[model samples]
Target: MHPFALIVSEPIKIDIWSDIACPWCYIGKRNLEGGISSLGDDAPEVEITYHSFELAPDTPVDFEGSEVDFLAKHKGLPAERVHEMLDHVTGVAANAGLDYHFDTLQHTKTLKAHELLHFAKEQGRQLELAERLFRAYFTEGRHVGRIDELVELASEIGLDTGAAREALESGRFAPAVQADIAQAQAYGINGVPFFVIDGKYGVSGAQPREVFARALTQVADEKAA
Candidate 1:
């Protein structure tokens, strides 16, 4: 055998733009994780960075209505139509092992939640906090828009809640959240759950695990070549 050791390439970077209030974003997250798992032992290492993208920036911090009501008002659709849409997505979420509770969902402004994500990034717990936030908003129907609730969530993920509160209250990470949004606009992305692989390939919507697997494999092959 040769004395030389094998060299491993740098991990592929995946930048994901998503909103906490987006059900599809949560689905996309699970699909992405599934894709990574499908690669098995030979799966190329990947670094994922979550970016902020608010779908309903104009929404009130405390929207006093059901999810269906909020959707009906915001999208100019009837309650029946909104219910249908929610039901379809809820079924889709179930297939992806997500329990979506739209009935109890609090449709509130996610700017504060996004800010908390940025704070988590600085603490090296961005991904953990992202999953927590998604579950909190969609599954548990927790109020992620409030500072106190977000601080509690941060602590759940083993982050420094004190620092998280300070960062959020001071709005220090608001600019970072805005920067991510600006970058998304520059890319002409108008939706959540948008994935940019290696900063070259763009995958929109919550695609199947096979689709993500193929994309990752293709990028790995290209980089290897």
Candidate 2:
């Protein structure tokens, strides 16, 4: 195995292991961006690296229920409670400067989605594709579990659609995706939106902007020491 390199840049590095289908992961991204915005240009340089985590590894490619229904069944919550929870999440998303179209999200597995993410990384458009996938899955009612749909989405992100489709078809990056999952397990991660700063400190969940700001500041300070 190759030796692991520490953050080589002058700026602190934040590695985020998240799933596109996860609502809190999207919120966590906004929170980090918000903290960075508040930190301004002079804020210590920051390198953001995205890793993969699957919230529902065994979910079906063609999930057989509405998102609300799926969540209800999965969590064994009443439909009313599920709706109430979604309403809360929607409000939280709005506060974080995002749109939550929970009703539009398809409840499906995202293994292929992660593979495409790796492909996008090679093309230097992983973040863009990630954002577009989030929007498509969470707000556009798009099915991210299918290769064709993911390829079409890649096209929207200005990625090489043909290459992306071929990669997906050939099951490239499956190991990368699985390696990420294994790393997550090794780190004792049990959920999405897990943020690792400077490869040491970990922050989890969709915390508020202040929380993210503090974490960034702490990591920057520690590195300076």
Candidate 3:
């Protein structure tokens, strides 16, 4: 009789720190998903954890006009040049299966959004709401910084609106937001789309699928040992 083949199974966890306002972060997320799915059913059961990292932490609650205007004003670029950049990003986003509506995007700080995401974590819908928030800002052109908009988005994703609003209004999740930022700083992570595989391997930027695939396999091997 042939000897039975041995297969080692293990568990893995991925912690991701990103912000909704970040475009590359969403692209990186899609790449990571591709790598994970390639591992198949026999692969380790992975737990995904989302962390809050606001990209535009200093943005104001309201801006004078469009995203283009805001970018031009903040970066000192010509309005035409900023629009051109927005066009380029919009094209890239579409190719990545995302609909980017920068024209309607209102300039606002993300502190409240981060706090709301922390609130979503308590209900186990942190990942979903995070994705939704990204979509709303980068695609739907919704003002993500406002409490009412966040409450509406939360409710749309099956969370309790009242609870989310309360959390935002009362600043309940402020500590969680600060903690994530502090941890990122502690880890020397000053950017989005940072991936920590099995809590051991860290990858930054919008890495390619193959890179993530290799990291996934490496982490799996380390765990099976």
lDDT of 2 at 151: 93
Pick the winner on lDDT between candidates 1 and 2.
Answer: 1
Model 1: pairs clashing at backbone N, Cα or C within 3 Å: none
Ranking by lDDT: 1, 2, 3
- RMSD versus native structure for model 2: 4.5
Per-model TM-score on C-alpha atoms: 0.97, 0.92, 0.88
For candidate 1, the lDDT comes to 0.96
Better of 1 and 2 by TM-score: 1
Residues 1-225, candidate 3, lDDT per residue (tens digit)? 347977646567888999877778887887777777776774557778888897767778776687877778778999999889988877766766778788777778888988988888889998898789888888778898888998999999999987888999999889988999999999999998898888778999878777887887887777777
Q: How close is candidate 1 to the true structure, as a TM-score?
A: 0.97
Per-candidate Cα lDDT values, in order, are 0.96, 0.88, 0.83
Q: Per-residue lDDT for 1-225 in model 1, tens only?
A: 566978679999999999999999999999999999999997889999999999999999989999999889999999999999999999999999999999889889999999999999888999999999999999998999999999999999999888999999999999999999999999999998999999999999999999999999999999999
lDDT of 3: 0.83
Indicate the worst ten consecutive residues by lDDT in candidate 3. Answer: 1-10
lDDT of 2 by residue, 39-96 (tens): 7764678878789899888789999878888888888999999999999988999998
Q: What residue pairs are clashing in model 3?
A: none
How does model 2 fare in lDDT? 0.88
Residue-level error in angstroms, candidate 3, position 107: 2.4
